[model samples]
Target: MSAFLMENKKLLLDGSVIACVEQRDGEWEDTFICMGENMWLWNRTFTVTDARESWDDFPMEFILQGEVAFYMIPGVNYNGNFWGEGKEPKGLLDDGIPWRFAGHRSGVRAGMLAQTKEAAVGIFAAQENPMGCSMEMERAEKKGFCMRLHFPEQEGPRVYCARDSYEAGKYMETTCFCKKNLVFSAWIVVREPQKQHDYAAFLDKAWEVCREEGSVRLLTDEQVWELGMDFAKNRLYFEEDGFAGFCMGLTWKDKGWEQKRDYLEIGWVGQNASLAVSLLYEYAIFGEKEALRRGLSVLDVWCGRAALPNGLFRCRFDQIRKWGGRIDNDEERNDAANLYSAVTELLEAYHLLAELGIERKLYRKTALAICSFVTQHQLESGKMAKAWFNDGRISDAEGTVGCYLAEALCFGWKECKSREFLNAARAGFSYYYKEFEKYGYTTAGALDTCCVDKESAIPLLRCALELFEITGEREYLEAAKQVSSYLASWQYHYNVQYGGHTLLGQMGYRTRGGTSVSVQHHHIDCYGLEFYEAWKKLAKYTGKEIWRERAEALWENALQNISDGTLVIKGQKRPRGSQDEGILQTRWHTKRGEYFGVSEWLVAWNTAFRLKILRKDFLARKREKSKEEKRIS
Candidate 1:
């Protein structure tokens, strides 16, 4: 034990040692060790050898500063023979680990037990021993025994008391005291590392490190070409050809019951519908019939005219449905809005299908049904309120809803060339423009309020830009510029750590004062990278190089700070007034350096859009550069 103490002096110097001992037949045995530091105790165990052959000594050492003393008590043995003789002595034996009764007035009592020697530690907090000393020992005998020591004050004499006993094995409990408060970090020593990464190939040959270590399931004709597979066999197709239903995203490999439940719950149909529309457009350009067919089927599902009679559109079935298949009123309205966007996407799919010369009456009927529903729901003001909410009224206005409406209206205008559809799109754009003008690019309402910054600002900016592109309206372009300018002003210029390059621009009076500068609310819901990308695109389209430069810098900073492929956004700073409260602050770190899922939906969409835009722009630049090079030559 002394040698072990000498060996682990560094760890011991940082904390006090707590020892638990058991005595049977006048022989003492050490059970566990706990190290106390700060205000928390960490549990550890060590092996000790008896100094005397007689085995009567219990020797433990703890370094102490200022006045300190030790207290002890003899173990009360509860042998089965003594129980028959009398209850008092047997009662003492029945309680497994001893207890300390001294600081009762201060309202402090604690218990410790070792479930097994192999386990690291055991701890229990109590105002008083619940089972009394005797019953505690009986319980310990059934399982294992435990011991607890209490040191109320380090400034005075230290006292230890034995209260009860239980079944015995190796376990430890620790306590620490400091002037302010105790900080705790658990040190766990497992037999094997919890996580492992492969680096052997990189070590051997750095160039070979780029090789992927996972399986690839190509779901596109282009992917087939890339993989050198037969085009016919590799062509992407829906699971049910000619049947309309949403495509599933990534599937879990484990196929566990919980994963299955989650799969059914959200459905993620809206995003899938968007993916399908994009894929269909790609298929038309690439002349891939299988991809085109699959995309058309998905569009049919989005339009709510699926092969299944009662199948809803891309409405996120589970979110809308409550118990007994009753739909939540608010969710139903949101679902309706989602379906509206899906229907608009279906219009695009129809155009692609027509271009591909795939004639199916299903597409026409689906399109007509969608138009009828949309027309029926239009208000006198040329905009439609969300449906299926309380009293079937749409009162609360949100940015995303307006964005979806604008998108749907644009689709309608292009498809039918209707004046009413154009007006509807204009009205949706008006809502966002007016709101942004009034709020000055800051999020309106309280921090706790729904449809906060991410929900409102980004969508509003997106719709404004789209409106400008479709209508060629200078007013819409100016409005988009205003919103973009406001968004850029709140880019969190000084601290890259706080809020991750974007601030929660809107705040209520109550929360504004208390809001932590560096802390990000999980509910803010905006994608920093997406905002940057959107601004960058707008800058390119408008020939505004400054906007492009600013957005590029923000994007680079965000990527540098908060991204790894598995997107975790930790709070970069402690909350206001938390410095003295003794809490650990948050940090941004991820396993994948270049990619992070900070906002999965936004990031994915933004990345796809940026890649498309950049590819086209790159080719144009390359052509211009080649022409110049030829002239020079």
Candidate 2:
């Protein structure tokens, strides 16, 4: 520990040792390493205030078995249970590691944790006050992993308790007392010969180095081609309905139960249908029947027997009993909120098949059915009900629904040359366009008063771009650029260090993803899996490298985010560092999901999309080279 601290001090970029510790009215503070002048490199504000008193030992700081050091800062809840009581739930859960909690007034508020013992691997967060902790899994007890920071007392400095720090356009909490806020960052020390779970540490460090190097790498088009192909080729295969049909897809074993595609889940058939276009080309090149077969399976699932008898996409199967079939043998769960996704995916599938010289007769019919359902059920105001059911009760109106389906309608009109379809899309656009005009970038697309989010924003962005392509309307292009610019600000390009783990370079950024929240209502981590493609389209529409640069940055971060499954899963020769699709992880640092199969199941759809994006970049480079060669000649 002594030599580790010595080496750590030298790497701190002007860090100083201060073994000061103190506790007042149950609030704990430890004098973490101090920083010298010019803290702006980290984009953080740092402060050092003389305390009323100091102790020989730093409170809440301890060296575990003379190998690991841990620190827990005192914190309080601005919201959630015990807020009025001036207390918070027991602090547990490390930084960077994710957890899921639910229900009324049940919330976790805490500060950052960083471990820099011999090797850097542990939880970490930045010094952002009023930070709400999301998850404290059921396993936290057995693992002895818990939140170290908790609610500040009823009588602490009002500076840390200020909620007025929230700015209109900013997402992170800022303080007027910038100079008073403590900013801590140091390397976590690590010794060799630890458990395999610790490899997550090594991967994180390697990811940081790669990000710092991505912009400067000198690789040829051939080399880039190879890198993409390697990533695309690493996919898990599966046999469904005896065709060796699908790649690992949306459905995966979760808590011993199979989560399926019926729900139009973000990671399931919806994603697969979108990827089938690329998979067809993959099949053409490699003669891999699985690629073509999976593409067909996507069609069958979206439009064939898997679809509702009434032609609506099923959001879930109506269950009769555990592991039983739908209650009526073919009952459907129709959350009309996502009809746009179903229609758009089906449209893509139809186009790919038609181009490949495959008959899309059935695909076109299913696509039309969904389109007709929306137009028929749509209210005179052009607002579609949130769900399709016998009761016909409206659930919610989200802009995402109108825009996504509108784009599909445009495609439908183009294919069939149908005036009704084009007019229907126009009506949906008029309704959604008003919403956009009213709020612009802040459009949440949800009647639930949701904030503008990456989840809905990405789809809206694509829809706007699609509309622009079809109509050559400046409004559509303007919409795309406005949303793209807003989302770009959401990217986490700065640095964060806690315990001993640091997120810098490319590993610290996520250009393709954004956080989702309903403002003062709630906040949660969200994966913008669809943004990479939308950004690519946006780049082409605008002819700007900024959008293209965002897509490339996201691709790099996606590589940085492969899960450390070796830590939790056993019996694999090595950790399943990356997968072709079974489970989808929302955040980069942890392999787990907010809940459900994502903790274990990898979906084929996710991997397919990942491979497709790499392919896009691959072809992009090839095209650039061809144009450059022509110019040179």
Candidate 3:
């Protein structure tokens, strides 16, 4: 063990030694370094006193100042820059804002990982702090970049009523804090490079560092599956004079559950057809006739009416007006991600119906038409346009947004046995993988935000794994492992502290395994559900237990805040089996204050994502039980 003492507390890193030294009047810092066989642990604690009488937040900022070649604060700043056009980020959570680059521990993994020429260093904080913490990375001129961890994290370009539409704005002033006495502690790990990139080395230690925090699972898989099915069939499912499908979902306000947005959206948040697939699962597993009828009815409506003339599918239906809706304009254009989702769900629906000896040629036909359009228009570089109108005109052409289509193409290839679909899928994955290698991250995955994000990495991982399975290629398997590190960065490794008054806190919500949405959207969601299967497969293929653990952890996180008929928030009751779309894990402005809570948008995807997973697990367990019973008999 080694200790250092100095006046100006700055962390020092040379090729041989990693240490920090700092001490001043009214401030005391203790630093220790313990060497291990493969990894070294560095511990730091700061004690400080404030003379000010009162303040809203008191912060203790710790710096792992060093000269490093690469640095990233996951889901936030990657290599101290933003991707895309040079324009400033538009929303309250601006991705391009200079210096004000701190993200709440809950919004990310609450750590900074950097790589020097020889080794990888990760600095992570414990999440039990009442005021929360934030991780920031900034370039320090000739000295390289500095990774700063903030306790009671406060930075400027502070936001108020962020993205609220009614009262949204930001300021350049720094968030001030004054507390009489404060103590902050964090753990640091230094390890040798183990993979082609340093991300894995740091992520490995990060998981180990936070393993003690553990996770809490509120409901069993069986209970969750049953509640979710009921919610989908009874509450979220919709029927009208001519149309039968699922509405987007209910929203909460001071009033009780309100079903104001009466629309059947095909993909993204609406997940009408996607949830119907879940209904099919319930029917297949539990033999519920209504589930089968409702599921097929919803799919039938979409398959019959959604195909557009220009070979694209209309993804949204305004139920109130009984008309098809186009995204972003009056034309027939649709966002790439939503369009990909619509195609994928249609393909899945086709598979289920076929298995039941039910002919759904319309479903198969519509999906193939849309996918054929994609393969025909695929760029020479394997890039697909972000959005396209029914007239075959491109709306937006830049960014990795087209990567969303990669998974859909892969599935389409399997169904049709078309080399065109397979080739496009391979090309798209290759292009996006190269882009990620060049930029150190993925971008524009989320439709609302056009900046670096974690969601885009999902398709990359899925495509890589799927390709590896189909072709038996080791290169694709390696790509999946690399992408897993990037995906892991977006997940919360520890349980974040929530204020007692907040809904999340009141319910004892654990942030662990909840994935942050993106850099521009500073919130957590069940997006992890999209890629847990890939993680589980990576574990099986690579024989790495860490990937398996992560997959399980992510499953539990997605189940948080699921309403079991009696779930209530803000003195209002939520429908059973419903779950909010976004959880405000940090001090970000939203409908639910600038603290920990939920956005009250009980999106259909949240329930659908869980139902899909639970249905799979439940059936597997039943199969195992059946085998055991047969053995005894």
Candidate 4:
């Protein structure tokens, strides 16, 4: 066994220090120890490992002797005035999509630069990893500019996406993953100052050297699942009344454009269409009637004065102060309009619940009325605006309301066999074809800036495929393939932060796969996870498993974003302003300048959506298998 340490007080602020230890032949585990006024003595190992091309249930470990981890060679470095996160990096890349890790929007960030002017390897907070660690860059230090990354033996809770969490400086221990033993891991590529360093090339070379050692072994799928469950068993959100279940949308302090930080003072009195959808899943998952009761309660809240006489739910409850369904606060106008999303979710859930031997007459009535509303007011242009007021006049249409309407009409026609619904859907397809003719597969999103938005694009993609499935129109099927291919183009191929929230480190981010760019909100949302589901369906429709491969890669990356409920994990009711268990937020990666509307808020609906997708995928595959078996027979 061999151990080594390097300390350079001259490299950082007073008391700031950096050190590393390595043993070539030992268990595959590695830890980072950093200390100083500018640095914290934080300990992080690759928390999750065992990748089979993409993230797999089985984690495969290796025993090695002379492997490379990373390097920040101090003595020999070259030119650029200062180099850190680039607008776009050549090796580890993030093209500023909504699926980016938090805080990585102002370009590729969370890196350290050894500036010639400062003569210090200054660690800048790169925001591409999880929110569990923190550092303070104090440029006003009289003695000297100090970049401090302090790690307390016992740190506070993980900060969220709100303004306060951004202001509260700290790191979550579980944010980054690095569970490997390293004999040769250093920071900064050691080379002559002017020489070029090809990170991708070096990484390939490193892997080659290790592979030659015969130390690597593959893991079976069963092993992958066993390992993941082993970790899952210890998670807090799995318990009842866990953090995720409390305040479903926990309060946080959001400092809007104002310079002062203020707490987000809002109580979630229920009545969110999205939450209703989630409760249905909670019932399905745990067979709890209480879950269904909570869901019905949410739907019930929207009734009475909150809804129009026609049963259209208001976007925000004046009494509860929560806005969702199709009408969310992200919209600048028409705070009260009926959304295709709200209508569709209610209709689908009503149908599913009715099948489960539980029927709510009000829900059925409301859903049926929304269907009548769609057919009653058909757009000549074959598209509906994103929102319509109680009077049935278009209030907000720029937000891709048409996409939702298109699907709603299709599903409505299938459910009620309304020729009017089918005609409306047909008209919408014509509009889509015109767009296809003009711009290929990238259709108009909710806004003009994004020609291809995941928000609208997802529904549009599904609409095309569903239309094809329903009508067997070659045109719709062809359109589905085009839209599917275009959506696939926007996928994030790499993680820029692999070594979890550490500067000049490779662990947390630096791992990639999911990120979407469109006119919708410019932040990660669990809804984006649908990209995978869409791809899988397209694969089934187009008869090309290649689409499923793409779906798997994106899904694996998305898995990194899902977190269990917070209440149980954190051990208290979001102590002050931190996350609790059950608040799943796997929408990592954020492009700068997009509205992270409730980006940090717990969205259990996303988990439910994913579960729904998994079931749909499983059933679809089963159906295909049944068909194949029949043909074979």
Candidate 5:
């Protein structure tokens, strides 16, 4: 038999010190002498004879100790019991005898005669509680050594410490401590080495296969252009035609495949819209006269004129142009008016273009048409809705309609300097608040009254924040805060089976009468993280620190589950099964959840907005710091 020992004080794992030991001589025995501060000790002792002769039947023994409880790995089979509540020996292994253990363990194997120095173990420590302990190992080996330890604070304030040493056939002792109790986890992974293959040659063959498969004809020109722009933005290779189209349209049949597939699928459309708008803005703002003119021509084709009579412009072809069965008794009219509010964004784009002195006749005509339609539709309550189909009468004002009206009115107020438009905008904002005040600034029901009790509280909250920004009204700010508070109260907390807060724990599900159904019962369209970001901004702007903190926590939790650069949608509530129909199945059962596809777009937009607000905050902080430095000087 052989024995070895190696120690380095500087090498740490998650913030905890780790020491590895190997038994070489006859069966070796060791008892944990002491437990250190913020430390966890795990021992895996295997017989050398069995390991060498019958490698498959290697008899291994493991002992683990921590400040509080010992959590067994998912597949390791062992029995343990806790002796005391505080400073107690926990786990069946703590019963003063070796606990029976059996499992097909596969991981790093240490040779009995080999003594190699390895990095120290580290762990994440709790902020307030400081715990320390030590473990003593008895073996047939000799000599003890120590190394350096370092703990670096991360965004989550998690830390790690490690040490290494090299000695054979010796007893080992390790001591570790931290300012707080550390909660850290690590896993052992096992995988077979891959066989040699010619990746370059494989790719060349794949290209031939792709061409033969007729994959070149799959993507449209717009898609190809969007692909190029995205590649340019990321500094990735710009593939023209076949290469770009194939990469953007690939799909698979499994969960992993679904994730990659949705990215390519959604990216095809989203990237196009983003690239088109960005190009137009860039040209309008910074391009030369000729460049601006070229950009404008492209924008005109990409952002086609609305087919509906309502003066709204269609930014993309995918947006439903006509909500059929609507219009006054006159001939069938185009449906672009449904998205009248989106016209503000287009106008903003045009304004940027105008700044570059790129004058276009259509720009003025489109802008004026939108303004006139908004003016004509203003109702006495300061609310406006285009006439409903099959009925010439104006529809009742509510829900998303209020959001649209408020946005459009705000735009009109900006351009026309008309009190009527501003008043109408204010009234629409007020109407929404009044209707859903019971829900605490949340929208009470659908704008079109399609659903009975489902409230679009998120959109309403968003609109309220925007209104507050435009008007600087304290009431709007207060409404936003209340809505944010309502949302926080609904966050999921603990496991439902574990008696934890239900709503905020697993998923954010739609509720009626305080009862939430399974996620499978509802459409996943409501899933969005932007509302949290908006709340964070509202909190910072209004000096509501608590709201900001809560928003931060929710954001962190959501971000943790992102896999393959995509957010996973877990059960917000238990899935209700397949009863819920009409919704796209692709959007459901998505590994990242159905919302994964659109989440990037929403996250990007929200982040852009938040960054603008944060920039202001940053500047204020810098100014204050400078003033303080001057005073000190």
Candidate 6:
């Protein structure tokens, strides 16, 4: 034990606090006092004896170094670094490059979680100081991975992109310069591993601590839905070549719209199919003819042109007119998650068509064909490939990408009544859940980043609920509850402190309930919109009010920073219903602007999903209330 471990109870494998005033400097003077069982406060103050004009970036870290365990930095780093020189088993795109970022890069919460067989630990630093926070895992003298939480967070060598490639990244330096005195403090919690090995236990405790400290939620679901629907109908919808759909994304720059032509994508950024489903729901509830026409027309395009011989469809459609309707030579690869989303949305549209007494054969045929092709590709291990070439050849098969397929297959079985789809769904779900049980983390739900991420766990929650609803199985409901815990680990249960001048701060953006993308991407988005229904189902099935509360929290997070058309950022007025794809909760961002500014690429899916859930879940409830009133009258 080092001098920092003054308590009788040992918290870490090698109980020591590694302090670095500079990269080469030795440990700085500090004081540690035990507060409670397995809890302590490390407080220190730096009064600069010799001051320079300014030091923009300096390396100073106070790390609670420990043995390598199942390490996770919420939405930031996952299970150590999965980067190396060669093509390794778990390498991501831009393979062979090392990756790490500042602590604020973590999703809703800025904390690190680590677990050994015997104990689990959570480390967090108050963000009140000028020095930001960051977590790193690298080989040291010890054989295990240690938790290195940096005070005055800094990413050196090169800064990373929160979106895709890091080749264009800028170098960033940490600064604790010019200050007369700097005070830094951190909270550390150590506890025995849960008996059932609940991997998210420490994260839950951290959330409790955060709640005790403070957090904020600013918007309600109703307000968000109204603003979101207005944006979707006015700005997102487009029609060309007899095809109607939502654009992939929109942008406002130099005080005007930047995208000169319409770009349509099927999923991820485009979310054309999902948005179409929302339009159909609007027609159903509000008797809107325009919504019905646009929704059906969008579905018609995919069903007529995009479907391939193997049942998989082309995901990109922007080049359709440019290519004179011939897009076979395009090099675009179809990701499993996007394809799954397309199929799910198609099935939903098919059901709506049937209800409204409209022709639905095309929608049904396309959805079934897609499901059949996906089921045919399942491995003997019950795992599905992550992406495939246009000709049906598997391109990449890794991570929990298959989790999305499982949910899609379950939906297929429910609508199409195919045993193959049902069997495939069950096998796929079981395989992924067992993998989660073993590793205690999910991975690669986002196509752009291949690492442990919260998005992958989302399908497990949906699939579990689907199976439970289909078979009335208690075990599946239990699985849903378990997966919800893992998903919660990625959610911010507290508000992250940001400088008042930053765009997010100006908007009073609440980090509470927003989800971080992947470990490689260090920003928050409304991705939690996908998890809302699963949480609500869990609440209904288990009578757990926490799940319901989480459902609302996730909803609010998804709806934050939405432009009411009057909202402006960087002198550009946001079109009504437009919300940025990324909320820069940290200094790291995709756009080169204010470090804490929102990524102003007003994405269609932001409004697409909000409108979707609003119509499907909330508006459906209101419809039921109206029907009951009519019966009573």
> 4 or 6: which has the higher lDDT?
6
Stretches of candidate 5 exceeding 4 Å from the true structure: 1-275, 279-298, 302-304, 307-310, 313-341, 360-368, 382-401, 438-455, 466-472, 489-529, 550-633
Q: Write the per-residue lDDT of candidate 2 for residues 39-115, one digit (tens) a residue.
A: 11112123334563432111122122222233222111211111111112222322333222211111111222223
RMSD of each: 22.6, 15.4, 5.1, 17.2, 22.2, 5.3
Q: List the residue pairs that clash in candidate 3.
A: 565-576
Q: Per-residue lDDT for 69-104 in model 6, tens only?
A: 566666655564463121212211223443445666
Steric overlap count per candidate:
30, 41, 1, 73, 77, 9
Cα lDDT, all candidates:
0.34, 0.41, 0.69, 0.39, 0.32, 0.69
Off by over 4 Å in 2: 1-272, 275-278, 307-311, 315-331, 336-338, 390-395, 398-401, 436-452, 501-526, 563-601, 612-633
* lDDT (Cα) of model 6: 0.69
Q: Which ten residues in a row have the lowest lDDT in candidate 5?
A: 104-113
Candidate 1, residues 1-633, lDDT tens digits: the string is 111121232212214332222333322222233332111233322222333343211222222222211111111121121211122123223235332222111101122112121221222221122111111222243223333333221101111111111122212122222212222111111111111211111111211111121112212323222221121112212244224433222221333101112121111222445545655554644456775666565555444422122223325433322322353344443333454445555665566567667765565455444444555555655544433343234544433334455556666677777777667667766765665554333232211233223323555566677777776777767666666643542232221112233222110001100111111121111134445656776887778765665465443332221112232223222111111100011111122211112211111222222222333344346568879999999
Q: In candidate 4, what are the lDDT values of residues 1-633, reduced to their tens digit?
A: 111222432222233322122233322344434432223222223223343233211111111112112221111111210222211111111122111123232111222222222122323231223332222222222333322322211112322232212222233243222434212222221111121121222222222222222211123323332322222122211212111211233333443111111111111112145445545655654466865676666566554324455544454443223333344333323221225545666776777678668776666566656667766666677766655665567665543436666776777788778888778877876675465444323333433232334445676677787788888888887676665544543443333332323321411322234444432222333344665676777777668766776566555544542332232221222221122111112222222212221233433333334444454334346568879999999
List candidate 3 stretches off by more than 4 Å. Answer: 1-29, 35-69, 84-103, 106-110, 116-119, 126-135, 141-144, 150-153, 157-161, 164-184, 191-197, 260-263, 319-330, 592-594, 616-633
Sorted on lDDT, best first, the list reads: 3, 6, 2, 4, 1, 5
TM-score of 1: 0.43
Q: Which lDDT value does model 6 have at 84?
A: 17
Which tens-of-lDDT digit does each residue in 496-546 have in candidate 5?
111123322343321111111111122222223446567678768877565
Candidate 6 clashing pairs, residues 3+ apart or interchain: 57-174, 58-174, 68-144, 68-145, 103-133, 103-134, 108-492, 131-152, 132-153
Residue runs of model 1 more than 4 Å from their true location after superposition: 1-270, 285-290, 304-314, 317-331, 335-337, 360-400, 441-449, 469-472, 489-520, 523-537, 550-633
What's the lDDT for residue 432 in model 1? 55
